[model samples]
Target: MFQLVSTIVIRRLLVAIPTLLLLSLVVFVVLRLLPVDPLAMMLPPSATAADSAALRQQMGMDKPIPVQFLIWLWDAARGSLGNSINFRQPVVGLMVTALPATIELAVVGLVLALMISIPGGVIAYVLYKRKRETAADLVVTLLQSIPSFLWSLLLILVFGVLWPVVPFSGRVGQEVTLPGITGFAMIDLLVTGQFQAWLSALSHLFLPALALALSFAPLVIRVLRSGLIDAANEPYVEVARLRGLSETRILWRHMLKNAALPTITMIGVQFGFLFGGALLVEMIFGFPGLGNLMVQAVRGNDLPLIQGISLIFCVLMLAITVVVDVLYALLNPKLRNL
Candidate 1:
């Protein structure tokens, strides 16, 4: 097992090197090719020629595009991604400050997705099992077909505009003031014993998380339900039944265990969607996160910030891929043995 894990880790790292290189090259080329210059955008239009020269030199933009990318790549390797043009802070510092919010949102969204998916999947499978074409199944199918952003709009319309049950946008209420502990508002509030602030933050979080959950749950439900149906028809399930195992035990312990692999794979794949979905959702609802930061950076032509965020996102996706591979091996021990 240890040897297999080591091999997988090494192989994944090897694969990630080329993937990151290609990503960096693409992002650098694309950003440089844009008509706007970061320095020009940052400086006033009335600035003289010497000022422009000095700014370009300072930003290393006076160099050839290839050389500039090389320098940026070198700096990135050293964990210094330069500074953000818009925020006037180190790219690393900006990412550190903003990443916690995005992470918190994504984690909450994933939890909500799982909570909705697991039960819905079992119920769907049961309906399919009994051959009952119910309204619940129709609802699930409709939800599966709709895009996440549409759900965001629907959530905003229903919960924000009409009923006003949850806060429309933002990560916390203005009235709830608390010191930043871990950068996550809810955690910071809870650690400081500010229950009201925590509740406020949670309420603010619900709408976006719900949007993400609604978007992801249908996929899980479909995948898990198919797995369950297939696993149920296997001869081992009948053998387990003949061996006096309860139906519930056979379903959950035996069937669900085997059925979980595809769902787990789907969850791994959906991590990217969660982050990508959060980008639009954050933009829609005015949530201050990495997504918001990226939008601002793009508008301001902040190359450093854009490159740093893109690189970080690419690394994160690669990391998720590695994690999924490991989980796949662990769950299907046959691969590990091989």
Candidate 2:
């Protein structure tokens, strides 16, 4: 099993290298092709043509496209991603600081999404078998039809503006400052025994996390429901039903377990969507995550920052895919042979 896992990891890494390289090239080309000039970001509006040319030359933007790409790639290989033209900080430093926040948000949001989606989907399927066209089904359909960002806006208006149940934007209250251990607010707060800070952090996290969860929950539910329905009709489930097993026992032990494989796979696949949604969600709530940093980089035409972030995202996706594949293999032993 260890050998198998190692072989899988090696093979996946081999594929991931080229995939990331292609992604790097695409990001590099797209940023260069954008009409916005990075020089405009660096210089004053009154700066003359000569000044612009000189600045471009000094920054090595005057190099040929292929030459520029080769130099950037070489620097990247050496763990030097250059500096953020806008923030004037090391691109790697910016990513390191921002990555944890984004990861924390995404993990929390996924937890929230799974917490609701799994049970909701399972119960819905169980109930639907007894009665078709139930209210739960309709609710799922309605939620799926509405755009996530629109729901985010509505949530902000209702919860943030009207009732004021939770903090509207940002990670924590301005007055509350906890140690940045692990750069995860909840973790840091708990580790320091700062319950008040923890509560405040939860309050700030609730809305954005809820919004992100609601956005992805419908898809998760749909996938789970379909998988549950199919699994319930399998031969093993039929055998269990005939062997004097209770309906609940058969459903939970046999059907749900088998059904869960697909749902888990779907969760991994939907990670990209979750990450993409985080970009808008972070911007709307003023959360200082990688997505927000990415948005700022784009507006400033920060090539190194953009390339770094994009490459990071591509690497993350590839790593996730490998984990999901391994999980699928473990859950369904038939896949182990492959």
Candidate 3:
């Protein structure tokens, strides 16, 4: 098992390295090709020619694009992601501040999605077996039809405007200040024994997280229901039935385990979408996260910040893919042979 796991890890790393390199090159080139002038955006209108030249030289924008990319790549390799022109801070520092919030939000959203989707999937599968799948199918379609941003807007209108049950915008209420130990508001608040602040954070988190969950849960339900239905038709299911196993036992003991494999894989794939969706949701909810940072970078034409954030996102996606592959292999031993 150790050897197999080692092989999988090595193989995934081999693929990921080249993929990351290619993606970095592409991002660098694309950002350079954009028509907006970073220097113009950053400099004051009263700045003279010498000022422009000096700033350009300082940022290495005076160099050829290829040379600029090489220098940036070298600096990145040496753990310097360059300064954000907009924020006027180190890109690394900005990411450190923003990434944890994004992670916290995404994780909460994913957990909520799983909480909703797993039971939904089982119920849908049961309905499928009973040939009464209309209601389940309708719910899936309704959820899937609306994009996450629309869900965010609707959630805000209903939960934020109409009922006003929870705090709809921000990570925590301004009055609830906790020391940033882990950078995660909820964890930091809890660690400081700020139970009231923690509750405020949870309240602020719910709408955006629910938007993400609603957007993500439909696909999970569909995938899991399909996997269960397929598992139900397998020969082992027949044997379990022949052995006088109750339908519930056969499903819980036999079908769920196998069906979960594909569901897990689907969840892994959907996590990327969840991150993408979180960007918009964060924007709508005024949540400070990488998505919000990226948007600011773009608006201000902060190429360095954009490149850093894009590379981080690419790396995260690759890491998630590797983890999913490893999990898939662990759960299905037959993959070890490959």
Enumerate residue pairs that collide in model 3: none
Lowest lDDT block of 10, candidate 2: 126-135
Model 1, residue 249: C-alpha shift (Å): 2.3
- Write candidate 1's Cα lDDT for 1-338 as tens digits: 87787888999999999999999999999999998868876679799999999998988898998999899889988989999898889999999888888888888999999999998888888788465747767888899887778898999999899988889778889897757778998888888888988999999999888888898899899899999999999999999999999988898889988899988998998889899988888888888889989999998999999999999899888888888888888998679679
- Which rank order by TM-score, best down to worst? 3, 2, 1
Measured with C-alpha atoms, the lDDT of residue 11 in candidate 3 is 91
In angstroms, give how far residue 327 of model 3 lies from its true place. 1.5
In the order shown, what is each candidate's alpha-carbon RMSD? 1.9, 1.7, 1.6
lDDT tens digits, residue span 138-182, model 3: 879999999989999999899779988898888899897759898
Arranged by lDDT with the best first, the candidates are 3, 1, 2
Off by over 4 Å in 3: 129-131, 336-338
Candidate 2 lDDT over 1-338, as tens digits, reads 66667777889999998998888888888888888787688888799999999999988899987788889899999998889999989999999888888888888889999898988888788776576647788889888776656767888999989988889788889989859778888898999999998999889888888888898999898888899889877898889888999988988788887888988888898898888888888899998899999999988878889889998999889988999877877788676666
Error of 3 at 317 (Å): 0.6
RMSD of 1: 1.9
Kindly give the stretch of ten consecutive residues in candidate 1 with the minimal lDDT sum: 128-137
Q: TM-score per candidate, in order?
A: 0.93, 0.94, 0.96
- The reply for model 1, stretches above 4 Å from the true place, is 129-131, 134-137, 336-338
Q: Which ten residues in a row have the lowest lDDT in candidate 3?
A: 127-136
1 or 3, greater by TM-score: 3
